[model samples]
Target: MGVWGFLKTQFVVHLLIGFVFVISGLIINFLQLCTLPLWGANKQLYRRINCRLSYSLWSQLVMLLEWWSGTQCTLFTDQETVDHFGKEHVIIILNHNFEIDFLCGWTMCERFGVLGSSKVLAKKELLMVPLIGWTWYFLEIVFCKRKWEEDRDTVIQGLQNLRDYPEYMWFLLYCEGTRFTETKHKISMEVADKKGLARLKYHLLPRTRGFTTAVQCLRGTVSAVYDVTLNFRENKNPSLLGILYGKKYEADMCVRRFPLEEIPLDEKEAADWLHKLYQEKDALQERYFQEGTFPGPQILPPPPAMDSPKLPILGHPPPLTSNLVCNWYLRQRLPPLLILSFLGFMWTASFAVRRLIGVTEIERGSSYGNSEVKKRD
Candidate 1:
C-alpha cells in the first residue's frame, strides 16, 4: 500500500494520540485543583483564570473533533441574537439526541471563547467517564441524578454555586435528560401522552423538573435562556470516536435566546414554562425538517486564531508584586503543561513498543483447504 493509505489505517497511531489526550486532560484537572489557594486570596480572578486554563486543555480535544476528525459544524443562528451573545450569561437548552452533542456544544463554546468556562447540567452517570468527567468537576459542570425526588435539592445547590462565576458562560441543559434512541423515543411519547401532551416524533419525554429547578435557582444570575436544537445533516449518528477518527459530518445548531423574565419564578409555573418551551422547540424542529434550517439570519463567530491576547511581556520576571497574579498565572499554565508533557512521553513509549514488538500479520486459510494442510502452514 502507498504511504498515505498506510497512514489512514494506523490504528496504533490513533491510540497513541488518545493517550496524549487522556494524560493532558488529567494534568489540566490537577492544575485546576491546585488553584484552591488562589481562590482563597482572590475568588473572582482565580475563577476567571481557571476558566481560561481549563479551556486550553479541553479545547485541544475539541479541536481533534474538527481539525483532526474533519467534522464540520454549521450553526444557523439569528444575526441580531448572536452578535451580542458573548456579552451575556445564558441558560442553553439543547436537544439530547446525539452522543457527541456535548462535544459539539464544546465546539460552539470554543468558538465563542467560553469552552473552558462552559457549564453543563449533566447526568451523574457522566461523571464516571474518566478524563472528561474528572476535568468537568473543576469546570463546575453540574451533575443531576434524573430522579427529581433525589436531585431537586442537590441540583438547586449546584446552580447556586455558579452565582459568582467570574466570566461570561454558556450553561448547557439537556431537557430531555437522555439521548434519543428509537426505543427511548417511543417510551417518551407514551409518557407525554400520559401527561396530556402531544407525541413528538423525534424526541423523548422531557423531564420538566430539572429545567424548572435550574430556572428557579439561576434566575437573577443568568440573563437569558438560549433554546438550542442540534441536528446532524442526513440524520447521521456521530460518536465521539467517529469524530476523533476524522469522520466528516455536518451539524446544525439553532439558538433562540429569550430574556430571563419570560421564565416564571414560581416552581410550578417554571415547570409549565419548560413544557411550553419544549412544545415550541418541537414545532421549530418540524419546521426545520420542512425548510432545512431555522428561521434566522446567519451569524458565525470569527475563527479561533483571531482571538490573540493583548498583554505585553517584559524581558524578565516581575518582582513578586502580587501573590494573586503569581498564583493565577501558575494555576493557568502549570498542571496542563505537565500532564500534556507526561502524556506525550507515554504516547512515545507506546509507539516505541509497537515498533519494537512488531505486529504479526495473520493470514486466513481457505475453507476448501484440508485442515492438516492449514495446520502445517
Candidate 2:
C-alpha cells in the first residue's frame, strides 16, 4: 500500500481524530450551555451567538466526516431553490433509512449556512442521546414520542417556537417515525394495502400525525416543503463506521420544492399531503431503480468549506470488528443504559422515601393516641 493509504488504514489515527472531534464538540456545547441565562436578558443576541458557536462545533464534526474520512457529499438541488435554501425558512421532509442521512443533511445545511439553526422532528429517544441530543435541545429540534396522544400538543408548541427564530432554518421531518427495517417495511406495506395505495419497496409506513402538526404549526412561517429523496448507488447497508473506514459510495439526493399553497391547510388534508409526498418519493425511487436517476435538473452544491486538498483515498479495509464493537458499545448501548440506570436508581429511592414516610406517620399516630389515652386517665 502507498504511504498515504497505509496511514489511512491505521486504527489509532482514526481513533485520535474521532476522539478529538468528540472532545472539542463537548467543550463547544458546554460553552453554549453557559449562554442559557443570557436568553432571558437578550434573547436574539443570545440566539445569534449560540448559532455561531453551534456551527463551529457541528462543522468540526462534519469536517471530520467529510474531510478527514474523505467522504464526498454532493447535492443535486436546482440553483434557484438551492440559493434560497439558507436564505429563508422551509420544511424539509427526508427519508430516514440511513444513520448518516441526518449527518449528510447537516452537512448540506452547513454548506447553505444554516447548520447552526436547522431543526428536526426527531424521535423522543434521541433527546436522551448525548452531545447530539443536548445540542438539539438548544437548537430547538422538535422531539416526538411517536405516539400522537402524547406528542401532539408538545410538537405543535415546538413548531410554534420556530415561528420567530432569529436565523433561517430547515425544519426536517422524517414522517416515518423510525428507521426502515424489513419488519417495519412489511408492516408499512400492510398499512398501505389497507389504505388502497400502492406499496413501496424502499420505505416504512410514515406516521402522519407529526407531519400534519408540522404543516399546521409552520403554515405561514415556512415557505415551501423540500421533499428530499435520497438513495445510495450501491444499495448496501450504510453505517457511520462503514463511511468512516473509507467506504466509497455514491448518493443521489433529489430535492423538489413544493410551494406551501399546494399543500392543504387542514389536519386531515396535511396528513393526506404527506401520504402523497411519500407516494411520489416512492415513484421517484422506482424511476431510480429502472433508469438509475431522478428525472430533474441536478444542481451540485459547492464543495464544503472544510474540504482539504491533502486527503488520502483509501479503499475499504478488513472490517475492524474491534472498532465497530467499541463504537456499538459506546454509541448504541452505553448512553441509554446509563440513563436507564439513573432512572432506576431514582425510582428505587422514591419508593424507599415513600415507605419511610409511611412508617414515620404510623409512629406519630401511635404516639398521639398514647398521649390522648394518658390525658383521659
Candidate 3:
C-alpha cells in the first residue's frame, strides 16, 4: 500500500479525526446555545446563524464521505429537475437501507447548497446525542417516539415552525424509520401481511404517519416531495465506520419530484400516496439490482465529480456573504485551532469557577467555626 493509504488505516489517525470532530462539534453546539436568546429578537437571523453552525459540524462528515473516503454520488435526474434543487423547500423521502444512507442524503444537500440547513425526521433519542443531535434541536428538526398518538402533534408543530424560515431546506424523512436488516425486514414483511400491503424485497414497509404529517403540516410551505432512492455499488452494505476507514464506494440516487398540490389533502389519502410511492421505490431498487442503474438517464457524466456546478433555480438568491464566510472559516480554521481555543477556554473557566467556589466555602466554614468557638468560650 502507498504511504497515505497505510496512514489511512491507522487506528490513531481515525481516533484523532473523531476527536477533532467531537471537540469542534461541541464548540459549535455552544455557539448555538448562545443564539437561543437571539430568537425572540430576530428569528430569521437566528435561523441563518444556526444554518451556518450546522454546516460546520455536518460538512465534516460530508468531507469524510466525499473527499477522504472518495465516495462518488451520482444523481439520476434530468437537467430541468436539477435546476430547482436548492431554491425551494423540499420533503425528501429516502430509502433507509444502508448505515450511511443519511450521509448520501447530506451529499445531495451539499451539492444543492442546503447542507447547512437540512433537517430530518429523527428519533427522539438522538436529541440527547452530543453534537449532531444538539445542533438539530436548534434547526427545528422534528423528533418522534415512533408512536402516532404522541408524535402527531409534535411533528406537525415542528413542521409548522418552518413556515417562514429564511433559507431553503431539504427536510429528510426516512419513512422506513430504521436501517434495513434481514431480520427486521422479515418482521416488517410480516406486519405488511397483516395490513394486506404489498411485500417489499429491497425495503421495509414505510411508516406513513411521519410522511403524511409532514405533508399535511407543511402543505403550502414546502414545494415538492423528492422521492429519493439510494443504492451503493460493489458494497451492498456501507457503514459509517467504513467511510471513516477511507473505503471507497459509489452511491446512486434516483430522485423524482412531485408537487405538493398534487398530493391528496386528506390524511388517509396522503398515507396511501406514500405507500404507493414506496412501492414504486421498491420497483426502482429491483431495476437497480438487475441493470446496475436507475430507470432515468444520467444527468452528469459517469463517476460524479464533487466540484460540479449545481443546477440554477429560477429565483435562487445571489450568493450571500454569510455563506462564503462560514464556509471559509469552517474549512480553513475550525478543526484544529478553534477546537484548542474553545477547549482551553472551557477548561480554564471551569477550573477558576471551581477554585473560587471552593475557597469561598472554606472561608465561610472557618468563620462559622470561629463563631461557635467564641460562643463556647
**Maximum-lDDT candidate:** 3
Q: How do the predictions measure up, each by TM-score?
A: 0.78, 0.77, 0.80
**If ranked by lDDT, best first, what sequence of candidates would result?**
3, 2, 1
Clashing pairs in 2: none
User: What would the per-residue lDDT of candidate 1 be over residues 48-131, giving only the tens digit for each residue?
Assistant: 767766665566556667666667677677677777566778888998767677778877776666766788887776586665
- How would you encode candidate 2's per-residue C-alpha lDDT over 334-360 as one tens digit per residue? 577786774454455434323322332
Candidate 1 yields a Cα-based lDDT of: 0.67
Best by TM-score: 3
Off by over 4 Å in 2: 304-377
Please report how far candidate 1 places residue 190 from its true position, in Å.
Answer: 1.5
Our tally of clashes for model 2 stands at: 0
By the lDDT metric, which is better: model 2 or model 3? 3
In the order shown, the candidates' Cα RMSDs to the true structure are 11.9, 15.5, 14.2
Residues 1-377, model 3: lDDT tens digits: 68877887886565446545555667778989999999999999888888877776677677778877888888898877888888899999998766678888887787777888888988887687566678899998888887788887888888899888888889999888776666667777877999999999988888888888888788888999999999988646776667767788999999899999989999899988988998999999899988899977776523322332222211112222223434554676567778787556555543432332333231221231132245557
Q: lDDT scores for all predictions?
A: 0.67, 0.68, 0.75
